[model samples]
Target: MLRAIAVAVLAIGIILVALVEAPIPAVALTAVTGVTILLLLWPRSSRDSVAPSAPEPPMADARAPIEAISDPLLIVAGSRVEQANAAARKLFGAHVVGEDVRVAIRHPAATDRLAARQATADQEPIELAGIGGRDNRWQMHVADLAGDRALVHLVDRSEGHAAERMRVDFVANASHELRTPLAAILGYVETLDDDAAAEAGTRKRFLRIIRDEAWRMQRLVEDLMSLSRIEAEKFRAPETAVDLAGLAKEVHATIRDAADPRSCDVAIAIDEGLPLVAGDRAQLSQLLHNLVGNAMKYGRPGTPVTIRASRGPGAMVRLSVEDQGDGIAPEHLPRLTERFYRVAPSRSRSLGGTGLGLAIVKHIVERHRGRLDIRSTPGEGTIVNALLPIAPLSSNRNATVTGPA
Candidate 1:
């Protein structure tokens, strides 16, 4: 196009020169027109031949349909930032473009791997700080793009890591708890078998020890089964309306009769007009039985274990088992609900505790959407409070309560 325009201007200049009668003026005008034509037709390279070539637009600009991704994408040229997608822009900010890859990402591990020229596939899991948020983990991959350009793709792995860690911890703890009972049972049985032909009294004592160990193992297995069942049925609430006061009375009566008649004293305080609770009748009975039985076994021989029940606020009933016995310290209180966690392991084992009683209690209370509180001081006593929501009374009968036993 420039060549055509220059030819037209030259032809006009020649025609104007021919029409003029003056030689010098026409000759000067012709020279000037010719120079203008030359200037217009000259190639750009002749003027600034040393100037550098302008860089090509990024390859990501004309990317394939597969490359037009919704996931975040980053284009890197060596250690420099070349381009970033909209998702990457939102994640790292718009200012990240044209900045050094290391400075833009602000993660030491990522920068170090890029600097070392190690392929990302061989690099350890690199923790990226301030990329998405503090807790987010990103696994990076480096792939070769056109020419020297490289693509860095990140995958979020925070949730996967957390789940794996939880699985590992659960397995370790469960195995440890189970091993304790198995080891004891195994050791006792081995000893009994080896010394069975000895003295009659010694053999009898060894046999008794073996029996106790077997019972302990049995209790642990049973508690595990019970926990599994409770977890499975936790979503469904009990269909029956349980009389909280009467249940408390039944538990108290059973415990009182079983108590040493001459030593331990049992007292019951079921306030009059206590409302019935919404709970499983059998589970509630077992809950009360466990709490009271724990108190009796651990309470001092002459001290009294008091069972109290009263109507609580918000259509709820509160039952408390208070025992005058050696209490738990503050540090041990938090872990009392963990399976196989005991304040005094030796004492708990001697008392034939499966170490799952408190854990079971916690699960049951949670299933009922109720609250359980344990309060204790080192030398005073411990109180276990179980609160359950009350069922509305039927129109025909008022809520009833049994008197103290």
Candidate 2:
């Protein structure tokens, strides 16, 4: 009857811990349950032979319950560490068991909070920067316990901090991008409004500039929308099979039909009998167009912009786009996929590039569970390869297949 009660109480303690932030009560309950089990399971003959003088210390009994927690937890009695869980030991060190809590943590904000003498009803969490490493962020929550003891819970906030930084940076960059073109269009329109600057030649030049800026804005908005859409469906890998050979030819023909001067220089080389890859058809089409369009914009006039598709190793299909132009510097290659990161901002703008082509391509590749590799030499030119897995036999059966041209 007592063992059953101990088990039920232990179960209740664990469930309560999950539902509340105050682990001290649960920890005490857990310690009591642990000691109860030990006393209940003692040899019946040994207990009958002699009466015990002192009960065993509960500190040893508390280790099992605390060790089950995943996050770093420390029980600080006064200024010194009473006990630490496995996670805390792993973080601060095995030697931190008896060390001062302030010395173990070693953060100004955390130290200040720990050293405070006045007792408060509620202790607010303190943010500790550079706790374990330079980029690490930790939230320190302290709960007052009996006998001046405190429960210190350290939650890693590094990933959340980084994601927030990225969101802020993205918004800033996007605003700047849109603002620049809009300013230009507004400036040109305001100048054209003046009779003095409204001569036939001047008016025509101003209107042309305005039209180009409008187109640039349009492209940026479209690319931004496309990126959002791709990110929204990133976890849902497309099960439909797409024909690489036909898609390559279609993208090439579309480019050929465009009015861009470098369109004629774009070439397509697709391997015969290439198996289909599982991917979204519309996204795949956009991916092809972005790759081919970027090559056309950056490659030198009258130079070849080759798009090749072939069966790759590991049952994957390799689609590569090569451009004959002054290649990107080695240092810039790694960050090329970051949005609004341009090697030559002025040059990119003049070429009508929205600075999102590679970023879009990257998200598209990620959504398809594919790999993107960009290889370049300063003078030799650049080539980008995307490796997409071939559709499985079962997926192929249900895939929407396109006929070859």
Candidate 3:
């Protein structure tokens, strides 16, 4: 009776573990566990007792729990794979069930731990790369089971590792970006305090340099903060209906009002009767400003930087900014949206770019559940397009927003 209770307890434990970790429903797990317990602890007839020498039923029953886990798990005994769950077979291969554990997991770190005759102080979770595929990463945890058996669980950590790496790289890049302008400001201030201040012209130039550096730093900080806010709210979609045509005109007016030389070259060609898009009004305004601003900065002087808005494929509203400038090389196109990535870092800095324009635009588009595309030819020019979804229950209306003649 005690033996039956132990078997019942084991079955219940497996089900509880599966309920916690596996994707299977709790009610389903409970029902399955009850059935499994009955089958494991039920009274055996004379014929079933005679078959006890055939195989160990209790141990075989334990395989159900192992298979319930989504992570790859293995039961290694005597340095050989005694049993492997479905996930393990899918990752290492179905043939790994009877293969040597060291051969099954090719990583040196995994091999060393799996091959150890006895538990040592060096036992810890092993990070294995290139296990399932190149760029794949897994955390291998080994727990010694009874009867010389080992339970090896592999959890995929590729995404978490990638996020951590991006975080580190972003910090380093931001520090360098901020440091450069700060160093410039400090050097200019020191020069102004010394012999350079004796000359009025030189002092003015030095002060101008300091002011520009300070403004650059200010812009960088603002962009960084904006990026953080956008990322924080990325998971929540904005449902506000935004009029694309009016936003385009507002951005154009703001650019023209600044009285910059490039403002004259800016052109707006928004389509008539364009529908409202589902987006945050402020973010969409910023997106337009970034795209159009990039165009004005990069496009050839006196050439048109056209901003066009019209209906797009499906339920999307297409907004594009076309610049007549030296187009980007194909190789640099893919990484353009990455923070601090620039085709010409020096030129970008000279034009007052914080290097976060496209990155912010990318995140903004992602938050709105839209698509962004950049097309360029080396000699012709580059065009950036953002397709945003039309707001539900919002239809096109007759509205006019025109740029300067």
Candidate 4:
């Protein structure tokens, strides 16, 4: 603007001078004055003569470390979402950049916190439920990067909350199971000692009650330990070849000899030449035992408990243990693998169950990268299907190849 005005004033002065003086002298005078003015107005290249460049942002360096984290990350400058990492882009979309932090996040609590004067250390993390979709849970953690700047991290807490709930329920159920047996054992033992004149028949019955209660406690403890071991090993896949059909035969025979007369007949109809499954032998055996035993225990009196193995697509083997008995309710089927859950708690206990059978089986199947399915009809029977991946051909060479039933 200044340069344009200077040029205009020089032109006007030249015109006024030309009107009052000779054309030759007026042109010469205009040229000298314009040249002098141009020399004075020209910009210099020295630092003192030039304008300063914009300063480097202090928080620019802070983004690299936050970007390295796998969780969603957002860098906020006052009310604006100045920067966002890849995860944040995936979660909230690319429009998050340059937008207000409150609008980008859209959660009231999170926006409120971002608008806060300071992010205190003791402030609770903001929980964002059903973000992106329902059934998803996220927790937002904010850290003060600098004045009016913050680092926001989003962590998925769905699995964490579920694990916590399972843990709490497990402890509660375990306590209840043990307390019942312990109370029974203590009460019966006290009765045996106090009744000196009790008949031999009465004394024998009392002793049997004591023994049963004690054994129930022992079995519960064993199952709890087994479940702990199985869960600890769930992340580590098994490599050993386990025979589901053979294991089923062994369990069937054992149950047959010990089964009550009124109990269902145990039948093993698995394929004899099925491919071996990649799994731990002992855990697989326990898996078969639990399924077969549950069938026998829960099946209708005098009905057949059928055990069958078949080859499936994708080099997988399926082991099915079915019972023709009072089938489980539809609602109960979903939580069948939960620890210490029972369709009929009294009946389950009376039949010598620890209630951890299905839970342990579930963990064992997971460790082997296998899938377990339970299907039942109201008036019919229940069938538990265990689908395990077949062992690699090279893994079973020169080894006792077995598969899950």
Best model number under lDDT: 3
What lDDT would candidate 3 get against the real structure?
Answer: 0.81
Q: Which one wins on TM-score? A: 3
**Candidate 2 lDDT by residue in tens digits, 1-405:** 665666677566566667655455346456434433533443332445567654333355546756655568787778999889888999899999999888898887887887773456676788988977898888877766544666777877787888788899999999999999899999988887766646799889988999999999999999999999998877667878788789888888989899987888988898899999988888888888888887777787888999999998888899999998889899999999999999999999998899899999999998787899999988778999998878874254324322211
lDDT ranking, high to low:
3, 2, 4, 1
Which lDDT tens digits does candidate 4 get at residues 138-180? 9887766434666677777777777777789889989999999
Query: What is candidate 1's lDDT per residue for 1-405, written digit by digit as tens?
Result: 665665565555555545644333344344334433433333332334434465544444223211233345567777788777666777789887788998888888877767764444454545554467866777765555444565666655666666667567656766776787678778877877887678888778766877777787777778778888886767665546788888888877776677456224778898998877778787887777778777877887788889899976676789888998899889988888877787888888788887778888887876666789999987888999988877663221212212111
C-alpha lDDT of all candidate models, in order: 0.68, 0.79, 0.81, 0.75
Give TM-scores for every candidate, taking all chains together and pairing residue i with residue i.
Answer: 0.60, 0.80, 0.80, 0.70
Segments of candidate 1 deviating more than 4 angstroms? 1-174, 259-264, 393-405
Which residue pairs in candidate 2 have backbone atoms (N, alpha carbon, C) closer than 3 angstroms, thus clashing?
none
Better of 2 and 3 by TM-score: 3
Worst 10 residues of 1 by lDDT: 396-405
2 versus 4: better TM-score goes to: 2
RMSD of 1: 22.3
Query: Candidate 3 on 1-405: residue-level lDDT in tens?
Result: 744665565566556665553343343334334434433343343235757565433346557666755668777777889888888999989899889888899888888877673657447788999998898889887766544666677878787788888999999999999999999999888777777437888888888899999999999999999999999878667878889899999898888888788998888998999999988999999998999889999999989999999999998999999998999999999999999999999999999999999999999998888899999998889999999989983322212212111
Rank order (by TM-score, best first): 3, 2, 4, 1
Q: Which residue pairs does candidate 4 place in steric collision? A: 242-402, 242-403, 243-402, 243-403, 244-403, 244-404, 244-405, 300-325, 319-405
Better of 1 and 3 by TM-score: 3
